[model samples]
Target: MTTVTSRPASAASMAWAGRASGVWLRLSVTAALLAAAGNIYALSDLEGIYGRETSAFVNQAIAQDAVDLAVVSPAIAVLAFLARRGSLRAYLTWLGAVAFMTYNYVIYTLSVHVGPLFLVWVAVLGLSAFSLIGGLAALDGQAVAARFDRAPRRPAGWLLVIVAALFTMLWLKDIVPATLAGRLPQSVSELALPSSPVHVLDLSFFLPAAFISGALLLRGRPWAYTTAPGLLAFLALTGLPIMVTPFVAQTRGDEPAWAVLPPIVGIVIACLAVLAGLMRPLPRATGTPVKVPVSRTDRRHPPHQDAAA
Candidate 1:
């Protein structure tokens, strides 16, 4: 049986990857620390940014802070560890972490009106954006793709599309009515906010990326391999909290449980699908097998040959 093996990535690519990983690690850690501190320490009875009850807003903030610490912080730590070890899975996971941080901080900056943590949110936002750009620039799409099996690509892509479409429907369900009526969305009004940050961000950025990346993967484009995992990771991490936050709010008597339950279930299922697809193993490539060094650490040993397509 013939097999194909991957060659070591170019030195320049390796260097770039190392640098990008370092940047992501530092920035993510810093952001996580600052966010945890700010959210936990900076509590007060301040007016809502839009107009919702201050108490309600504060409760939501507390719940979200818990999610940040419990969910996001751990994910970032794991991804950073993986990236440091030179795993493609870690690299892709890092991308998602960066995206999540960026998206998350942006929301905090816009939504939290009267807090000392505003500056912290701004700093995190800038750092996360830069980290994402640097990380994506450093990635070698083909090399990354070569590390993964092709079988899950289509399914993962479709899952992303479905998640994105669901977000669009959810947000538009509120936005389109308000837009047509030339009035603010009821949720926006209830919150006393000028607009919904979730709606704005989803419509402008996350949803579009999810749809595009999913489409690219389905078409078997090389870039899709690079983009899909990160998007999936981002969706999974962000989607989980979004699913749970409503339940938290409901338990606090801030919202009805039934109102949010269906979406929560849907998002949970979709996130699981994306994660499962990404975790699929790489298949051996077809062709004559060849040996290559996995990294400098492995150079003293004989080259390990593996089949991968």
Candidate 2:
């Protein structure tokens, strides 16, 4: 039987795996602070969007802001911590967090009217966009993949594909009919917004990434190992707030519980389940030996050959 041994990763690879760039770190810290401050201010002092005249979209935005303050703000801090350790997983997580922030701030910047926090939202949008590009560029896909074991890859891959497909169907279902009828989606009128930022961003970026990453993972491609976990984590973390938004609005009497509760609850359950699965430890590969050929002279006197020569 041929012996198979794992090749040890190079120092350079390990260094790259652990080292997050100073630029990314600084951007992440600044973004987190700004996000926290903006969300807090929105939750407490911002009333224009929360009053009786506010539309459904405005209420949803407020609720999402609450979630941002309570959940996503802290998540950015955690991403910073992970990145500081130079962890590949942490780096991926940071990327995901950036994606989530990018998506969130896009909605804020475009959909919401200009307000006290307008510039802050714009700053977040710009920072997140740059940070994401920087983070993705910095990562070594093969190095990141080497950090994880084989177990979770399949499940994570499938989950990502399923998520991508479902969201694609969900968005297109609304979009296609509206296009065919030459009418705006009801969400547009209800939210009183120019268009659906979620649809635009998801179709343009998020869903596509999900689908691509999922397909790669399913095929046992290296890129999947690098991208899928982060994508899944991003979706899960950001999605929690989305799932909670309707319930929050319902409690505030902005909308009926039945309208937003049931579907979101199911979504929440699915997201939580996948998040849990993804969080399971992916043990590093062990004892995967690669055969190195030994010449006859070396094999005959392995220990003394070099010294004798």
Candidate 3:
């Protein structure tokens, strides 16, 4: 008969697990920041479209955007706060609650402007956020690495790199035509949109930052853990204008080029879904000796003892 033995969780393994929590908290904030930054552009022109003359109607319309900000910003901030060593699920749950609140507000906020059709967007965002929160909560760092200690597997860090690459490509596609043409390019004019090269550059920064930040998480490096929030801040700032602003609606007539945002937004959602999926804990089997039943006499007198007798 064979006996199974259990291994104690090691410090290094525990450290890795702790860092996963930090990575997830930072990622949640990154997503929230993206939503916040996207709103910056959407909200910037709110007064213009709704018109200062129609202040009452316009302010009422945009109130929900402010509420969205209120719901998400604090959630991101709280996650960041609780992202210390050894607080994984609690931080993720807090962050998830924050995400849930934001999505709830998103439903209300989108409802005010577009209609029931856009409900899918809100649902997708809510579901994705919950998935990330869940993945972080369920991660078992020791078990994860232990199961794969000998086997080769794709690195979790690759997901962030892929997202960064995709965003980089989109940013280039969005900006190159304008930069080469000079004068904010034809797209801005066609879309009649307000844009700054500075903002475009700022958006481009998130790619390298996210890739680097996620790389740190993957490598289990010290600075990578420390700098995650800063990286997330970069992500949030770059992405905020996409979510909150009424930029899409405002671009209808003059700025056809600005219409690129909706597709980009869709891509961001898809990328996050993929990222969350990749982070999920995979079921792993460990090779251990299977235990078999033994008689009391056999247990009392092991093979060596029986031989000696």
Candidate 4:
């Protein structure tokens, strides 16, 4: 009985791997550029670009500044991963990606609601974009077998969907009326909430994120990598806006209720993205097995080829 051995890697497999590596490299470069841009913008004294609260996070410890640290830390970690190998790099890259994404979401929300603050947006976008870039950069020469099995297998995914949808429906009930009421020029001081559709759609985007994050953690992705940024990002983008509206109105001596989702789900999605990255499958060894090498004399001397030997 002959045992079949695996064959060497094929041209197609090599080509695919090359392409994947290239993509990761490009992503890393993008992340680095964005991070640099963010740093520059943060330094600029542009009005409506930096909020007092947001500025604190960004400018904290200029040498050890949190925003700079958070954004750059991941890139460094990603670089380390690329220079090295094994699960450690994978873990670091994954965590960095999560942090970057979460930061991105928060900055995105603030920029949209508070003001342009394009600098903050650029910074956050850079963090996320760079994280992805860094992540891909580190993946250069690495082979990953992409898998479609990241989606949760249990009923929990579905259950959360239903619950989130309901919350969205409830949240919407409060929002639409408020939005309509607030639309009036005289409505500045009136308490109003978001529309139902907004709540539902927001929830729809949010819950999946939470579910993804949770799943990633359970599947053993790092906390920082799987959960932090996504949760923070979602909260900043979706949760904070609603909370801020009332404060904004109150600061102006008015009262208004802006709709906000609980954000339980958004947290999950961020976590999942990290986990999914870590758990990404390695390339399956495919192709027919080739026989192991044997001595030419042995092959020629075989019962079937005695004359040839």
Candidate 5:
């Protein structure tokens, strides 16, 4: 019989992760700046910018831009700065912010019409995507999991599962029936978008991520600890835009999705609560050592060397 041992990450891999961290930090900061610029322009009354998009979609876009400018962009910069110091909690939060930007602009890049800020949108999208990828690459999942060894996984896991299910049902209720009936969902038609970017993105990526993260969390897997917080952050950020879109629509004299906003607000609050729960038990500064200051008496003489005193 041959025996094999699991080895810790090699110095080379660790060094690579360090380099990746630096790369992502720079990329995320650039993405944040670009997102801020792009969002400002989107929120502005730039002539022909929104361009033939339905009022509903444009109003939602305004809401998203507002949130991105006021919340997401600043979050990315601040969290990335903190993550650079190498805390797992900070890294997860930073990753979540990048994911929100990346996910958001994917919808913006595809849905919004071509205009002056198109390249800026594309640039932010690309930077955010790479930052998200690099941030994930830099994670040491097992090490991250170890810090949350005392976290209440079961409740948090179930909470994530419930949130995932709620969103799944929310989308699929519109999609599944419409698909079977061979007709477009009302939202798609109403919005006049070439396609349903939210549906496509959610079904293809975000929802699945939620389901996987939730399932793994239930199993108490090491990777789940690393994923759940970031997922929660994305949900929280995503929900904010959704929650505000209705109000934005109302303010603009469009018919607001008032019924949905309350539920969305609830979901956002749930995400935050679970995020705090998951993060509560984590030891601060994952790999960093804490220093204790020596008192003058201790500095002057060691306890075992009484004669020296």
Candidate 6:
């Protein structure tokens, strides 16, 4: 392992991250408030906006909006507020929150047909996408890697791998049978939607990302140090929505997914614990260029440079 020691904070590198995200932070607060307002009114069946949705689907949406209002919106606002102080941990967490909103609103704008909140959803999605991009732009990958020099990599890596494996298996259990039967799956049928966007997203994008992050982390890859924290946040945030959805269903006179709760809760707890370990060494304020002692590998010339010689 490369042992990296801390040095004086580099005001230049860390300052940019805070400054760059400032405008986005202000914009996100507005968007988050709008989202919160939408969530509150959605439960009232405002203007019969949900008139066309299946009972199950409406319940699911209610559950999601509840979590968004009660947990996500407030959490992101706080993270953004903290990130404005230039903490790497806070900035990364803020980025993850924006990522989650971007992901959620994609489903809302594309799959759900609520005309009243459609524009609100679009606004949230656009802002989050842009903010995620901007936040990533300000991130110093090498600096972050150096900070995590002694953090617990293996547990976080293995947790990601296990989460990915379990989810992949869960989604496939529905998909493979449907593919074989040449029919739409029950997951879709219950929601009365033509297709399951969650399944598509999980199988195509998120699960693969989880597995890749975990694998790279296991190998002590530098990139993983920067990438894994946000991913861990994402997983932790998502578990809230999934855990609450079933209860929302029960309250709304729909079938509760009780069986899903135990495993999901367990995953959330494990992810949070490991994530804390990974982030423990990270500074509450980040604004420094790292200066790890040079080693043999560090002294090695690039292949192109060697060729030039």
Per-candidate Cα RMSD to the true structure, in Å, reads: 5.2, 9.2, 15.1, 13.8, 9.0, 8.6
CA lDDT for candidate 3: 0.43
* TM-score between candidate 4 and the true structure: 0.38
Cα distance off (Å), candidate 1, residue 4: 12
Candidate 2's C-alpha runs over 4 A off are 1-19, 49-53, 257-279, 286-309
Worst 10-residue stretch by lDDT in candidate 5? Answer: 300-309
The residue-level lDDT of candidate 2 at 277 comes to 63
Pairs with backbone N, CA or C atoms under 3 Å apart (clashes), candidate 5: none
The TM-score, computed over Cα atoms with residue i paired to residue i, of candidate 5 is 0.84
- Give per-residue CA lDDT, model 4, range 4-24, as digits (tens): 222222321221222233334
Q: Whole-model Cα lDDT per candidate?
A: 0.66, 0.66, 0.43, 0.38, 0.73, 0.73
Number of the top TM-score candidate: 6
Tens digit of per-residue lDDT, candidate 2, span 179-241: 799988776657766678888888998899999998887776656766776787677766666
For lDDT, candidate 3 versus 5, the one ahead is 5
Candidate 2 lDDT: 0.66
* TM-score of each candidate structure, all chains considered together: 0.81, 0.82, 0.39, 0.38, 0.84, 0.85
Model 5 per-residue lDDT tens digits across residues 1-309: 111122221221232234344767788899899889878876776356786688888888888989999999998888766555444466677788889999988988898888888899899999999988977865656555555656677766787788778778988898888879998888798888656999899888888888888888888687787778888899899888888888888888988888987778887888888788777733332244322233343335322211100
lDDT of 6 by residue, 1-309 (tens): 444444333432343342354667777777788888888877777336677888877777877888899888998899877666555666667777777887888888888885888888889888888877776765556566555656789998898898999999988999899989998889898778888888888889888888998888887776676678888888988888889888888887777889989988998898889888887744433344543332233234211111100
Candidate 6 is scored at a TM of 0.85
Q: Is candidate 1 or candidate 4 better by TM-score?
A: 1
Off by over 4 Å in 3: 1-70, 77-85, 89-158, 186-204, 211-266, 278-309
Extract clashing residue pairs from model 6: 10-288
- Candidate 4 weakest ten by summed lDDT: 140-149
Ten consecutive residues with minimal summed lDDT in candidate 6?
A: 300-309
lDDT of 4 at 244: 39
C-alpha lDDT of residue 153 in model 6: 91
Residue ranges of candidate 6 with Cα displaced over 4 Å: 1-19, 282-309
